[model samples]
Target: MRPGIHPASRPVVFRDRAAGTLFLIPSTATASKTIEWEDGNTYPLIDVEISSASHPFSTGTARVVDAAGRIERFERRYGRRPAPSRG
Candidate 1:
């Protein structure tokens, strides 16, 4: 820990674009910008454009990818034949 050069730690609100929601938590950040909340208090609201809420995995939006087929194709073009399965 240093003396006076450390980043300021404060409470912040992170807004999720996908859910259109605000999450309040402690964070080192800047000051509030505008008064828009019900309490008339505004903190430096950090807006995150993307998160797991809208991402492919956590939101049941993942797509099936045939990566193994591509690997087989590459092997057909350049790689040697792998040893046959014994089990």
Candidate 2:
């Protein structure tokens, strides 16, 4: 319970440019622009390039790397090392 130690957090509108989505959340970030939300209130407007709505992992559009296949291919190309003999 210190006084003025933490940054002030307020409701700010974060707009995802790629997905064209808007989110109203409390943030310590600042913005020069302003916007009127659906609730008929004006809040700070923060434009973002991407968000969970447009991210590949969230949208299930990300490619899953085949590690095993890659290892097999690498072994096939550059032969596997022989087992070391115990002294």
Candidate 3:
């Protein structure tokens, strides 16, 4: 790894506002805000809208799309394509 040419990697706090969770991880991202962690240390705070804690897949609350319904709608609007001829 080259030194001085890369962005500085330091401890940053990612706050999942939806889940009220804070994760301390190394990042190159910078933030104007700061937060005091449980360990009595201050770190740059980055607020995120979504994370694994609040994601639909992680929470098992994802909605399954109806592929059949979409196909039916497309056929109704554009009609079905004819089968390809064998060469």
Q: Model 2, poorest ten-residue lDDT window? A: 78-87
- Evaluated against the true structure, the overall lDDT of model 3 is 0.97
Q: Encode model 1's per-residue lDDT on 1-87: one tens digit a residue.
A: 988998878768777788787777788877545325656777677788876667778789798889999888989899878799999
Indicate which candidate wins on TM-score: 2
Instruction: Please give the CA lDDT of all the candidate structures.
Output: 0.76, 0.97, 0.97
What lDDT does candidate 1 reach at residue 57? 83
For the record, the alpha-carbon RMSD of candidate 3 to the native fold, in angstroms, is 4.0
RMSD of each: 6.4, 2.7, 4.0
- Clashes in model 2: which pairs? none
Q: lDDT tens digits, residues 1-87, model 3?
A: 887899999999999999998999999999999999999999999999999989999999999999999999999999999999999
Candidate 1: what lDDT?
0.76
The count of residue-pair clashes in candidate 1 stands at 0
- Any idea how many clashes model 3 has? 0
Clash totals, every prediction? 0, 0, 0
